[model samples]
Target chain A: MSINEIQDSIIEDFSMYEDWADKYEFIIELGKELPAMNELYKIEENLIKGCQSRVWLHAHEEEGVLKFQADSDAIITKGIIGLLIKVFSGHTAQEIANTDIYFLKEIGLQEHLSPTRANGLVSMVKQIKNYAIAFNLKS
Target chain B: MGAITTGLNVQAIREDFPILKTLVHNKPLVYFDNAASTQKPKIVLDTEYHYYSSQYANIHRGVHYLSQIGTELYEKTRHIVKDFIGANSEREIIFTKGTTNSINLLAYSWSSAFLKPGDEILITGMEHHSNIVPWQLACQRHGATLKVVPLQEDGSINIDEVKNMISEKTRLFSFTYVSNALGTINPVKEMTAIAHQAGAHVLIDAAQAIQHIAINVQELNCDFLAFSGHKIYGPTGTGILYGKEALLDAMPPFEGGGDMIKDVKFEQTSFNELPFKFEAGTPNIAGTIALGTAIEYVEKIGLDNIFAYEEELLKYGTEQLQQINGLTIYGNSIHKSSVLSFLLDGAHPYDVGVILDHLGIAIRTGHHCTQPIMDYFCIPGTCRASIAFYNTKEEIDLLVTGIQRASKMLL
Candidate 1:
């Protein structure tokens, strides 16, 4: 599926629950289901520090397609990362770099995108974009 | 709803703060972030509005009627702060931006006058970055060594460790009266006595204490004390730095500016009097006057009563939170204030904080600018709910429910 298609699906999935608690529960479940990154990749170099939480992002490219793995100590942040990974992973670096993600607002998690929130989600998105840009330049 | 056991009249007190009626996410706002900054009372808000609307003027530099009123009200706050903290004189109270600015002013001025090469400056591990960074800069500027009084397992400092740390080489000892992160109320009088005995000037960071406890600088006999106005329901960009008259008189001016100088020439300039010398530039005229109003409001309620009521809330909160399984609280000191810092097993603080935020509960979740405390506990951070006099048992119950709900959702 396209990135927009996946984001729409996620938004639709969130729309099934009207209550904030249910929305968060779904995110928590997604967090639990996210594949854990290799412990070796969770190094100081990959770490993105926030005042409230920590995130680590790792990216590598294969055959002009980029794959991303990320983790956060915070479950909500991790769930958000899982959403981003699902949207961006297995896509070409050029396609990933060109995409303008707007699903966070659609899914009612736009607060995480604020720099003042300090949940590392904003930095993670920036890191993903930078990784895509670097890979695109190389390819 | 009228009054609680302490006769504090929590209901009426709640009404004084209009923001207490605010709703978040279709739920009533339960503010538990008092340590970060207290919500202003209607009187403080009105006073700020009234000042700007009617009595706004640049103080000390103008001869207009509004400027005179502004200068009078601003200086009235200085006297009120002097009396509020029981300082020896009005000249002892120097207004600054906030606790951070106050500490920086002291660090720069005092270290320039007193700190020497090989001299040692002591501070506690649980100090806010404001307290730690200024002294570090002072030590760097003056070729001095910085020492730390370590915290115990329970986040309280050992008095014996403090005594052992202070020596003849210790030129200054700065520490917080209460840990902003842990809510540990240190034995300020005893520690000040220890520092004085060692011939070291002491600075008490009262940023967290001035609101929750009664303070008397003369009784404590500390060389300097600093507190922010916003944390005490006053305006931001306003604070008090209470120092000994002799010490303040001895130090050089912190910033060379208009109000802080007696006379200025290209070749030579003379500094102003004690308080004005430290308080350079055009001050926060309106905020300073409103700070006086805030102090009056707190005085009307009485600090002893507020302290008693908050202690009860703290005890109730601690007891309720202790019942939750897999929850660990930091700062187990018996002499604690209204702050409760905790972490749930296997649930990150940020996750818990986000959940609570959705429940209309405002709490602080982070290292709270006390990274050393987090390092000591070997954790990233904890969820902190700092109570105020206006907070009630019902609010705490809501907080308990929110935390439980968060744990259920995250775990």
Candidate 2:
């Protein structure tokens, strides 16, 4: 599926929520379903700074396709990271690098997140893009 | 004033702050982050509006009617602040941007003149970055050393260690009156005496203490005291740096500009007198004026009553928070303010803060700009619920419920 298609599905899923409580419940559910990262890969070097929550993101290029795995101590942060991973992972480094995930705003996630959490979301996106850039250079 | 009756009409007080009436996430807003900043009372807002709408003019420089009125109102705020902090004279109050700005002023103006190459500046382990970074910069600039007074487990500084730390080489000692993150109230009066005995000038960072406790600079006997306006229900970008008149007079001007100068010539320029010497350029006139009203509002409510009511709230909050099975409260100081910093077992502070936000609760989670304290505690950060007098028992009960919900969702 295209990145837009995945984002649309997420948005449709989110639209079912009537209030912030329900929306956060959905996000927490998403967090529970996220694929866990390797404990060894959760090093200081892989940790994204500036997040109130500790987020560890690991990316490696396999056959010119960048695959990303991430984890966060915070459930909401993890859920957001999972969304970013779904959009950016398993794609060419070039394609991932060129992508801008406007789906957060389209899905009203940006508006939903508190100001500080919004900052964390931005940091998560930056870290993902940074990984893509590093892999793109290696390719 | 002796301990007044706790006749604090919290409902009426809540009415004074319009923000308290608003909804957050479809629930009644529960503001427990008073340490970050406070909601302005209607009077403070009205004062600012009144100044801009009716009493607008440039202060000090103008000889006209509006200017004269503005100058009087602005200068009158200095008097209110001077009396508020129990400083000797109005010359002691110097308006700066905030506590950070006030500290930087002292660091630059005072340290540049006094600090010699081997001199030491001492601060405590629990200081906010504002109190720490300025001295670090000053020491780096002047070839001086920055020393730290160690903290006890409950987060109070060891007074004996502070005495031992101060010596002939220690030229300046600055510390916070209250820990912003941990809520430990330090013994500033004794610390000031120790610094004085060691022949070191002292500066008290009252940014956290100003709202919760009554401050008397004379009683504390500190040479310099700094606090921000916003923390005390006043406007942002406005704060006070109360220095000893002799010290302020002797120290060079912090920033040289139009208002801060006596005469401007091509070859050389002389400086303005005490407070104006520090207050350069177009100041935050509206903010300064509004701060006077905030002081009056606090006075009207009576600091004694506020303190009593908040003490009761603190007791209730502490007892209730302790009941949470996995919740660990930081800073178990016997003497502390209305701040409650805690960590839920196996749950990140960020996640806790986010879930609380969804429940219409406002809290501060993170290092709280005091990374060194976080380092001391060996934790990333904490979820802090710093209460104000306006907060109620019911709101705290709601916070407890929110935390339970968050713990179940996150943990």
Q: Which candidate is the best by TM-score?
A: 1
Error of 1 at A17 (Å): 1.3
Clashing pairs in 1: none
lDDT of 1 by residue, A35-130 (tens): 999999999999999878899999988777889899999999998889999999999888888999989999788988999999888898989889
**DockQ for each numbered candidate:** 0.91, 0.70
Model 1 chain B, poorest ten-residue lDDT window?
B1-10
Candidate 2 lDDT for residue B270 = 91
lDDT string, candidate 1, B1-411, tens digits: 233578788888999999989999889999999999999999999998999998888899687899999899999999999999999899999999999999999899999999999999999998999999988988999899999999898889999999899999999999999999999999999999999999999999999999999999999999999999999999999998999999999999988878998999999999888888887788888888889999999999999999999998999899999999899999999899999999999999999998898889999999999998999999999999999999999998898888899888888
Residues B1-411, model 2: lDDT tens digits: 123237999888999999998898788899999999999999999999999999999999799999999999999999999889899999899999999999999999999678999999999999999999999999999999999998778988888999899999999999999999999999899999999998999999999999889889998899999999999999999999999999988898888887999999999999888888998899999999999999989988888888889988888899889998799999999998989999999888888997888789999999999998888889989999999999988888999999999988776
Best by lDDT: 1
Question: Which residue ranges in model 2 land beyond 4 Å of their true spot?
Answer: A111-119, A130-139, B1-5
What docking class should model 2 receive? Answer: medium
TM-score for the A chain of candidate 1: 0.97
Off by over 4 Å in 1: B1-3
